[model samples]
Target: MPNLPLTLGCWDYDRVQALMDGRVRPEGIDLTFLNMVVEETFFRMLRNREFDVSEMSMSSYLVSLTKPDRPFVAIPVFPSRFFRHSCIYVNADAGIDSPADLVGKRFGCPEYQMTAPVWIRGILSDHYGVPVDGPTYVTGGEEEPNRQEKVPLDLPPNFRVERIGPTDTLAQMLADGRIDAFHTARKPSTYDGVRVKRLFPDYVEVEKAYWRDTGIFPIMHVVAIRREVYEANRWIAMNLFQAFREAQRLTYEGLKETAALKGMLPWFNAHVEETFDTMGDDFWPYGVEPNRATLDTFLRYHHEQGLSPHKLSVDDMFAPETLEEFVI
Candidate 1:
């Protein structure tokens, strides 16, 4: 049989650019790449199984594991990783000087179960002594209206979450004093002025310290294949995983070739060198073993926050083929 053609959905990130441009081809597969906004890709995949393979929110993926019928299975190819400390924005007039000050305040999130907010919530509770249930949570769209949670959540009674009406975005709520702070993966539109500022002004320093302490560069998304597809073509998982790793390798090489600086930043090379110094040679790693710490912490957060019905081990998230590779 010929290599099966598959639709792969993801954001147009540099790491996945090579795959989309046909520079990196998965063995025994004809991939048709669909580059779109991450939210669109995730929503479509989860709600409708819109693609043969797609990028999915890690938190959402964990929660899906608890369901009776999960439509997708993931590989360890993490397309998006970020530090959530900088995702938090607080109103200047809210008297929130630190994560500790967030207690007893009203805070907004794009979604409570979204990957970024889950990481932010975990950081606040673990590092800064801010309890997850301490603040009232307002859930709504960050920039647009009429956004809804991708999965159904059975939050505990102690957790307080209020869904906003269609007229309001979380950004407007934070700026108008309806909420004291907001957390969104993307900067809220209201942050264009002084109305909103990050709770941690020196987030870069704080995030670096956090990484040094925890060795977790919070994973936001994992690449998943439709369950039906994976059942029929199990080898495709390893093939895709290897192809993604190759693409990531290309991205890292691009970051180091500053002789003719590919990006516009003047201090790009200095930053790249510092990143390798701080994060080690493999800055954005792809395999399951290398990212076990981050995976464990994220799963714990998901279960504790009522996003997942049970605590999921790292082994439950990926294909059996991904757990081992043939040595050449």
Candidate 2:
């Protein structure tokens, strides 16, 4: 049989290149990998008709698998870990001590629609019962190009939000005490000067907290294959899974080395290493079966908050047969 052409896409160029170069091997599956950011990969896959490889977000991949027109099987990219959304940083001069102090304060964020904002609002609403409706909210960019559309939450009638430009500007505003608090989707280590605090430390204690609490892990990103190509060349999908699994394992085991050699931006490198370390053990298999409990919880949370338009079931998000083959 002739070797089929396979395209494996990823955002982290160093990690993907390491895997392809044989310096890191997850589970022995070799692939022709293509490195790209998650958004770019998704758009490319969606636009291409002839491509057989799958392109998807981790969340969407599972959702698609459960759909009747399941485009491609889901695969595990890495282990699960507590992923904290936007870090809430208050300038020392702001005099805001806790969640309650956020009222009437000017808050800076990357955006109201991004994942960090969603998680932050959810935490505040579900835990503190603070009304986000009345606070002044500031977005980072004046205009976000190709921003991912998110479902809006019920902001308190008293809440006000405005769009500021760039993360640096937002941070500077916080530093100058212009904004009372800034919510960033970036990990805590990414920022300095201001004291960064997790919004819901108790609930999101570890990476698996989402899985344990809601049984539905938020789909971060996924490899999506075109439908026709998936049907015609099933092996490519399977092979890709094997390759990723191997890559993930190698990446985890060599986390320290990978960190050292990659020489990423100091904050980003630290955050990536910490994340990999936390998820090294509970990683999912590179196949379609998602952590049902995690998905269920996420859907329930989103649905209750009116974040998700439709209530989706486990079967509505993943393929049973594909999942069965990859469960670790």
For all candidates, the clash counts are 0, 47
Predicted candidate 1 versus true structure: per-residue lDDT over 1-328, tens digit per residue: 8989999999999899899999999999999999899999989998899899999998888878888887789999999999988889999899998778999999999888899989989889999899988999999888888789998889999899999998889888888888999988899888854788888888899999999999999999999999999999899999999999999899998998967986778888899899999999997889899999889999988887878767889999999899877898
What is candidate 1's CA lDDT for residue 287? 89
lDDT at residue 259 of model 2 (Cα atoms) = 29
Local distance difference test scores for all models: 0.90, 0.53
Off by over 4 Å in 1: none
Score candidate 2 by lDDT: 0.53
* lDDT at position 113, candidate 2: 43
Which regions of candidate 2 fall more than 4 Å away from where they truly are? 13-19, 22-30, 37-82, 93-95, 103-107, 111-113, 130-137, 140-169, 176-179, 187-191, 194-219, 231-235, 252-280, 283-290, 304-306, 326-328
Range of the 10 consecutive residues with the lowest summed lDDT in candidate 1:
192-201
lDDT by residue for model 2 (1-328), tens: 4456555665664335565576644332344566665556655664343244544544434334434565565444432223543356666667676678777778776555454454566556655666656458876532242232222244333446665643446655665667777775554332454453443345346435544554434444445666666577555555566666666666555555642644546675676666556555545434444456555555554444344447666554433334556456
